[model samples]
Target: MKWITHLEGGPKRVNHAAVIVGHKIYTFGGYCTGENSREYTSMDVHVLNTITFRWMKHPISDLNYYENDDILPFKRYGHTAVVYKDKVYIWGGRNDRSSCSNLFCFNTTWHCWTATKTSGDIPLARDGHTAVVWKNYMYIFGGFEEESDSFTNAVFSLNLETMRWTYIQTTGKIHAYIID
Candidate 1:
């Protein structure tokens, strides 16, 4: 494995979500806790070019608005992001303060962020959840919920075409974690 180096000019974060589209890795939401002491929950977008081995800041908006005029998502970690077609879907992550279940979408084609409205039984607020994309659906399972001091065993599915959510009930292979 090759160690990725020289990402110093961009955001320094941990627990950030990263997904690759084409030849680039798009990183989202991470906390910087060392000397910089920065919290990057609802911050900016950064890109790492795998081919060139360089890091660059990406614009997360269209040409219509400036940073002072647009609204974005909150800062979070342990969130999951998946790329399907031309869009990147961002869901559930928590920061030092709170957890949220809101869904945000960044259009790679348009270079804009759009808040998504989901239907059906929405999952509870969580972090560290694992999300996987298969075909046209996104499957989400288990995460740590700080408010209850417990881990989750629930499964949720989101339809990419319809933008709807559904809680799936299963009897086996339920995702869970142990707390001490």
Candidate 2:
């Protein structure tokens, strides 16, 4: 595995929720500590040029496409991000105070963000959910909900083309234990 290091200058303490695409690493909403020591502060979208190892802040004008200006998915942590069809999708994470159920998509081609209005049954608000892209669908499983403060074993799938969501059923423990 090849590792690269770069310096980011901003809030001293920020939550980490990001993904890597090509040579560029994109980090979405995260919280940071203020000079006054308040928490739950939201941060803007930031990008890192892997080749140059430099950080660049995204334009504020483009942020609207992501969702609500300041109120949307602001400075969230424990959220998950994945790149599909060259677009990045972020969903379900905790901000400074509460957990969210919003889903946002970033289109690299347009250099803008847009909120996804999903049809069908949507997953409940959660954080720490693991999302992975398999074929044309994005599969999400296993996460903790702040409201209940409990771990969930539900599985869900998002159809990228139809913009629909559906819950998956599992029998028994759905275990994949490997014994040697």
Candidate 3:
């Protein structure tokens, strides 16, 4: 395993999601425990410059539209994120309050978030799903829905160039190859 030098101001708990671009690590939406209280959602965005290993608060901006307003991925955990071209895409995750199936993208050049729309075969809302960029397509697989808390093995792909979705079937357990 490669050793990743610890970055500062990151959530200490496991399962929180994040994405990295260039040298800056951007973390938005995570769950953390409050002082002698229950777990709570976090909207704080943290930016860390990998080269200098410095951390700072990121400013929010309107760059994307969903439901006629600027859309930001809410505080979530177990979400999946990927970077394509110059944008970072974030997908479904769970939180103390709810689970999400929304998708949002961050434009590195513009430094803002934009919501993506798909026309057909949208995957159900889930958390812990894996999103990976294969060539020009974004492949998503396996996540648990909040209502069921049950893990899934569904595999789907999105053509980023065309913005379309294609569902793919697997022969065996999805976790088989995913696990060692």
Candidate 4:
């Protein structure tokens, strides 16, 4: 693969969640390393337009509201994202202090974030996981669980329609714990 160079104004981040919607590639929160080599999680959204090959930062709205209400998800890294319809759903990630179990959605059309309410067997707070959407469900698999202090290969699925999570049982020898 060839690297695209001179793409200025793009975010330099790691463990971020990225998804393609139309011709734009949307990237959400991750750890940003600065000139001093200090790293910190950023609550920012960057978008790359494939046609123009340019990056643009999307500003967050209602910053004041976020402080008063739980409207936005915290700055996170090692999260997983999937695009379903017009919105991108992000789940599983952590900042400096702790991991997260809440699911947040970024509306591409509206350019806003929403804390989605979910029910059923919500998986444990985790990071470094992967997610994909199939049919009407979003499947999340494997991540590092801080409470257990170990890697997990557990699989869970969230139904987009009902906003319910279900633990999926796996079969065969493919089941294995994650390793660093």
Candidate 5:
């Protein structure tokens, strides 16, 4: 196996989120370990070219530059990302203090993150969740809540075209975990 090594490129992070669109891999926010036992989350974005094995740091642009009525995703990890159409959607990741329930979308063509405005039943703030995009819809399930010290089995669906969130009821309780 030929291992790819490019230490001088991309974020030096752990628990970060990455998604492959076409042949390029885009990576976002994660945590960094510091000396003296310290850790902090990152908010940078990077693009990696698989064919050429090169990296291009695509730092997030200024929030004010975008004309939109949405907030930016916080610097976090343990979040889930899925590529639907040309946009990469990032949802539900936690930081040091607490978890987040916000949803953000990054347009591959535009190369920007848009804090998505969602309606209906938004899922609870969580981490360690799994997400998959299927037929213009994103399905999310199972994560953890640090505040309550609990695990979730609830499933959620997000309509990528309409930008809506819906809760899918399921019978049973099963504690699930996804390590990175």
Candidate 6:
């Protein structure tokens, strides 16, 4: 494969999650260093059209911006995101203070965010994890546990159809590593 340089209009970020859907790549939640030498976590959603090689920020509604609005996700970094069907599922990221266990979904077709309600054995909130989708399941594997102040080797899965989480027991020895 060859690497090609493209236009540079997108936001400069680190530890963000990027998922490809159709011909575009969608990036969410990461921190960027500001001019004052402070790190600011972002909640903006940016999209890159592969063919056009252009970047556009998708305006997402702010939390509690309207009456009876759904809870929006916080600005975070080191999150994991995966696409299941037309929606991009985001989970497990941390801000300056702490990590999160919430799941947020972005409908690619509608361009809207939905705070997903989950059930069953949900894993502890974490950051720097990896997530992938396979056969209607989103598998989350290994991240830093803020409460324990250590990295974890745990594995969990969420069923897309049922929205239920289940801890998966493995047999082999798998080392845990941070994904960002």
Candidate with maximal TM-score: 4
Global lDDT of each model? 0.78, 0.73, 0.71, 0.85, 0.79, 0.84
> Candidate 4 lDDT (Cα, whole model)?
0.85
Cα lDDT of model 5 by residue, 1-180, tens digit? 886675556667788889999999998777777622122323567888988888888756334323333556666778988999888999988877778887888899988777788998988899998999899899999899776789977799999899899999898766669999
lDDT of 4 by residue, 1-180 (tens): 989767889988889889999999998878776522222323678899999999988877225434634657777789998999999999989887889898888899998778899999999999998899999999999999988999988999999999999999988787458999
Which scores higher on lDDT, 4 or 5? 4
Q: Tell me which of candidates 3 and 6 scores higher on TM-score.
A: 6
Query: Which parts of model 1 are misplaced by more than 4 Å?
Result: 1-10, 34-41, 61-71, 173-180
For model 1, the run of ten residues with the poorest summed lDDT:
61-70
Q: Which regions of candidate 5 fall more than 4 Å away from where they truly are?
A: 4-7, 35-42, 61-70, 172-180
Spell out the clash pairs found in candidate 2.
30-75, 65-113
Clashing pairs in 1: 41-75, 41-76, 42-74, 42-75
- Per-model TM-score, in order, reads 0.81, 0.77, 0.78, 0.87, 0.82, 0.86
Model 6: residue 171 alpha-carbon error in angstroms? 1.9
TM-score of 2: 0.77
Per-residue lDDT of 104-157 in model 6, one digit per residue for the tens? 888999987788999999999999999999999999999998889899889999
Tens-digit per-residue lDDT, 1-180, candidate 2? 765664665323355567788898887765455432123433357787878877787774244423465344455767788899889988888765678777788787777666788888788888878999899898899899777779999899999889899999977856678999
Each candidate: RMSD: 4.3, 4.2, 4.3, 3.6, 4.3, 3.8
Stretches off by above 4 angstroms in model 6 are 35-42, 61-69, 175-180
Candidate 4 displacement at residue 89 in angstroms: 0.3
Count of backbone collisions within predicted model 6: 0
Clashing pairs in 5: none
Better of 3 and 6 by lDDT: 6
Better of 5 and 6 by TM-score: 6
Per-residue lDDT over 1-180 for candidate 3, one digit per residue giving the tens place of the 0 to 100 score: 986786556545456657788888877665566622123323446777888888877666222223334466655668887888888888887666677776788787887766787756778888878889989998999888666668877899988887788889779643435555
